[model samples]
Target: MDKNILGNNVITQIGILVHDIEKTSQAYADFFGIDKPDWSMTDTADIAQTEYRKQPTQARVKLAFFDMGSLQLELIEPDHNPSTWREYLNEHGEGPHHIAFVINGMKGKVAMMERNQMPLLQKGEYTGGRYAYMDTFNDLKIILELLEND
Candidate 1:
């Protein structure tokens, strides 16, 4: 594993795909003895552009974040449509979807992953950052998300 390819080995988030964001978030909060989590829906415009399985598409998701000191716990609820989260939930049910790492050199790292035979599954932009999800489920049994924030 080239260190420069993926930047540092610091995981910033653990994302889970769920059927219901509110319910799942409440469950997590209850189990962890924390307050109810607030869910935020992704803005349509903020996505800018999106691609799934190399095809242009639309994926709406409601998200909730829980801070756990170093890493964040992210819950994702997919709209009743075709999306990565929906596909994951339909195929594997509710569970861990991906592990995200904050990378400074996002574009370079994405290129390196491509060179290493990891296909990009999806890519999108948010308010102050962008993210790319790589297909590593077969090899690592988990998707890898590379995020770059401004």
Candidate 2:
């Protein structure tokens, strides 16, 4: 079977790290003149500690999502302990953390990456979608994904 390669699909969403979810959401709302999208918080302690290789210890995140016309934007903030987002913010201020794509097979994709020595940042199912993260670059950066419902 041909292993599905990364970037073989469209980027459905991009997660931007921010310190303030509401304020950041507002900025996007005003900038795009669109209403704020739904928001939620996740513990992520276990997922972060286990899955994310470059993640800071005890990683916690407060995230919000915004629908931008044809795409979606996710705003994330690292709390509890510092995270890749915090580090990125410290180095370059608020900006893109990871670009998420919709994939055909998430587990298979992740397994392929694993066999290739690329570690997964996280792997689990949420809201009926399979998600995973992997860091291939040196900057502790990674790609996020959403698997098509099987």
Candidate 3:
């Protein structure tokens, strides 16, 4: 396996699962003295075509982004549906969820992740891109989110 498969370890974002998006966004902004970012809901089931644990699902979440130079901090608040975010929040509570890397080819990267013992847990389509959550917690202590822009 190539050690540079993830492309130089450039992490574009750090995702955190939260119970309340408004509250958490306020807390982060207030604590850091930065402006609170507006949160937005993800795409609907029809557009997203989300899959969780190998099954078609309608799971969605609200997302807020805090830009800090090159690294973005993403806050996620999931609805009461079946999803990787819900599973993590339920099992681990509000905390760090995943670290994301923007890659070129998602299919190849996913295969590499799987070959490295990190199987895919969930995936979904966004407006201009798609994302996959790799089950790397056992090895890396956090899920790996691979974003592929189209």
Candidate 4:
């Protein structure tokens, strides 16, 4: 009768918001001694079906990822859209955004999180999977992202 909402405690990724992804990614690469990874933009709202605080919105971001052993470090540059990424960037400047976990049963996980008072801030679908951001900062000191690959 008891289970963690994420199903496990393994953090698969750490998402960082940046004003300039290219510069940040390069900095990470140089610091880590790895090649700078290419960045891509998130799909438009039509494709991603992005929702921010229950309203559908055209929010997208430039994204780049660095494979760091078992965890991936993500750099995100938001477009001025009404989205989690943009909001976080505007409010906090450039900094860490969310800690992500790969999980199954997206609906169940989201419901559990909401019941625990951590409401969903945003959600969207990508090519092969979907992601949800939970408002866990007050309790966990950080936002949490649930990634469900299908």
lDDT, model 2, position 52: 44
Which sections of candidate 3 miss by over 4 Å?
none
How does each model score on lDDT?
0.85, 0.67, 0.94, 0.93
Query: What tens digits encode model 4's per-residue C-alpha lDDT throughout 1-150?
Result: 235778899999999999999899999999989999999999988999999999999888999999998999999999987999999888899999999999999999999899889999999999999999999999899999999999
Expressed as tens digits, the lDDT of each residue in 1-150 for candidate 1 is 444577688999999998888888999999999998789987673354766777766777899999999999999998865667778889999999999999887778888888877878888888899999998787778999999999
Q: List TM-scores for all candidates, in order.
A: 0.92, 0.72, 0.96, 0.97
Which regions of candidate 4 deviate over 4 angstroms? Answer: 1-3
RMSD of each: 1.6, 4.0, 1.0, 1.3
Q: Where does candidate 4 clash, by residue pair?
A: none
| Clash count in backbone of candidate 4 | 0
Question: Residue 143 of candidate 4: its Cα lDDT?
Answer: 97
Question: TM-score of predicted model 1?
Answer: 0.92
Q: lDDT tens string, model 3, 36-132?
A: 9999999998999999988999999999999999999999999999999999999999999999999998999989988988899999999899999
lDDT per residue as tens, model 2, 4-85: 5664767778888887888889998889888887677764545433234543456567788887766788898877455555
C-alpha RMSD of candidate 2: 4.0
